[model samples]
Target: MTRHHSPTARLAARMGSGLALGALALGLASQATAAEDYRPQPDQTPIQSSKNESFFGKTMDYIENNSYGRLGVLRFQYYGSSSNLHVDNATGLAAQAFGPGGSDLPHTGSSAGNTTTLGAMIGLYLPKTNHHLAMEVQLAPPLKLDFQVSGDAVDQSLAPTALNGANGGSIPTGVPPLGKNLGTFKALPPNFTIVYRPWTHTLVQPYVGVGAMYLYTYDKDVNNKVLNAYGEPSLYLSKPVACVGQLGSDFNLPNNMFLNLDVKYVGCADVKSRVSNIKVNSPTLSPTFGPVDVGSVSSTNHFRAVLYQISFGMHF
Candidate 1:
């Protein structure tokens, strides 16, 4: 035990002792840093109240904290719609005379054109229910309803002699006839819908809805050519209540304002149109007949139309 160690051995032992001390110091510093990180800070807010909280609970908490006020939203919408009308069946004496290739007038199966117009709607979400239900009312300018008619029907119905025979005197000429332009009318449609929202935490919220609408048609304007043809024809259209389906998305903007894009489909219902007028002697009839007034004739047509609408809206 009294023997002294060599210089190389002593150097190796000193080096190993220094390395063990350094490792011990590094480990202590790492433990101190981990303990500091685990300690909660005074200003830090917990993301969850409990570690066992479910994802649904977290989502609801987020929605409750971040949602806008539950007070209802009012929206003003500008929309355009295209409608198609199909004639199902027709009846009455006028139908008999004009029954598809008859001498007087041709049968009309459907509208010759589409009614494309600009419309406006005002909608309000019912208070409560987090803006999930709404009611909307819409108004549009006069819409033209063009029905199919033959060129021969136009010429024969508006002939000078025929006009005089129907009117019982010399009538004015040179006025152009409204060929296929049957009439025009205005519509008042109101809707009630229940909306569904999939993502409530994002700025862009998309939704779908199903509803019903009452379509009130009024202010009928029959073409003068039609009137002259039938010697004072009166037109009538039945009001219908139809189902509605819609899809849309809303984009939140600054200052409580939002922009919306929407599309809707209005389901078909039984709609009817009736035309009643006094029949008169035509040029094709015997020439000996002198402006003879015939009995009144009428025709009824049952039809339905499906309307498609695209709209852009703004929040109030």
Candidate 2:
């Protein structure tokens, strides 16, 4: 139904209709803009993949492209070491008694020989240094070392009687009197080092390290014929801890294996030793002496050692 109205009312009705149409057009434009924004473009398309490809294959590809994955984090090595050890002659009773001039008293100093042993090393690579720095721990089993006393006869006057005594249990009467044999011992040395490598990808990589080492000696054998005449003798040694320096080179081989030559120098260490349980045996003693307890004798010895090692290593 249509109703006639005044001119002013007709103009107002027209204005209201124009406003409603403008609002409807604005709503339609906003909807169109949002739809265009969500639509995928050429650059936003998903990449295609082969159906036969696997997660393991993708992981291996990623590892081959990464540096850390190629170099690994841990290394293991097995080696053989030859140690050249030099121990200075002991002091105290050892010096006075074992000196060139002989007296009617117990005198002898201890000397150590060199040894060879098997060893192993484990190393860890530090992060973010491109394999330039690492920490290593090296260990070896007990090595056998022979100890002896070096000097002239204890008492030249009683030397003849002692040499000719029962079972030759007195003084050693050899041509030069080559001292007394103190027997063998076992020494174990272990070290921890921080190593630096200058070149990582070279065929021959050289490294230098500084560290600390500890020496432990045990299984003492005091079976000397001359010392046993007095009584059962007990031998004791002080453990030494010292600083060590290392220099080494590694030659790369196939299949992640390497051949290494390493040299280490241990600083001078002072070691002390004691020999106890000395009972005077009248038979071996001079005529002026009587049977009595002589207590114990102590000596100070200085030691220095150099280790040369050849090793085979693998990275993991």
Candidate 3:
């Protein structure tokens, strides 16, 4: 409708059209242009993994940084062991009195038997590795190593002395063979072992070790047969040295405590002991078997045993 209209009305209409076009242009510009992704400084590194919060790890870190210490804790162990006697080189007719008599215990002559005992252990860990140096001692009632023997001397009625110029003596009593408590086998000091672990953080901890042992014999009471024939009856044993090998695993517990199950195989040399004096009841044997004599009374015994050690320990 081309109707006559005022100049003011025309001006108003043009202004309204211009304002609407301006608004549309502004909205399109906003849609077309946007800021690029923000960039960080080269020194900054982005997180790649989740955070960890282990109580044990945090405690270890705190102790390592704040304190200076290397001393380790003391561990106590209760154990049971079974041992055997392997006689290697037994010489001298004199040894018949001590060895052939058989043993007092059922397993005596065939093998010495078992022991149940307590032990104390101390150790220090190497700087950063899993290696440690430790020493231990076993305290149990002495294990008797009893062997069998004829309990009496040759009958005095068979008076060989009468043949000689000497007066005949009364016959010695005749009694059956009996087992005598010769000595006690014990594992003593200078016990040293090296222990090592493969990993620090593990569900189950595994370890290995090797070491040596020094053994001692006590209460070496001679058999009754020897006491009747000889003036003095005593025994001697050479200290045995053994090589040890061990394998074990530890179970983790709370509060820095652990329980371990361990097994050890000890390889030992023959137990060769020299019975120093066997002065014979006969005058001629007196000269033959003197203190300074060899091949008189000496024996050899080999030994190997397994020890199961279960230990309860804690770290400081």
Give the number of the best model, judged by TM-score: 2
Please provide, for model 1 over 1-316, each residue's C-alpha lDDT reduced to its tens digit, 9 standing for 90 to 100: 0123455864585477457644543332233221212221122332433457654454334333222212122232212222222222323322333332222223322232356666555554433334554444444543544533334334444333323446466433332333666656555444556567676447888988777766555555555453455455555666677777778777766655566666666665555554444334444442453333333222323333444444555443
What ranking of all candidate models by TM-score puts the best one first?
A: 2, 1, 3
Give the per-residue lDDT digits (tens) of candidate 2, residues 13-127: 5477447534543332233221212222122332222346454443333222211111111121212121211222323333222333222233444556666667666565543
- Model 2 has an lDDT value of 0.52
- After aligning candidate 3 to the native by TM-score, how far in Å is the CA of 165 from where it should be? 20
Clashing pairs in 1: none
| Model 1, TM vs. native | 0.50
RMSD after CA superposition, every candidate: 29.6, 29.9, 33.7
* Candidate 2 to truth, TM: 0.56
Q: Write the per-residue lDDT of candidate 3 for residues 1-316, one digit (tens) a residue.
A: 1122355864585467447534443332232122121111122232121136344333333223211112222231212222222222323432332333222222322223355454434343432232332222222333444422211212221112211224544322222332433333333333456667675457577878888765555445454443336444445666678777778776767755667676767666555554444433434344444421122344455656666667675543
Off by over 4 Å in 1: 1-107, 110-113, 116-118, 139-178, 224-227, 278-281, 290-316
- Model 3 spans > 4 angstroms off: 1-113, 130-175, 185-190, 223-232, 276-296
- Model 2 clashing residue pairs (backbone): 97-107
Model 1, position 81: C-alpha lDDT score = 22
Clashes of 1: 0
Taking all chains together, each candidate's TM-score versus the true structure is: 0.50, 0.56, 0.48
lDDT of 1 at 36: 14
Alpha-carbon shift of residue 61 in model 2 (angstroms): 18
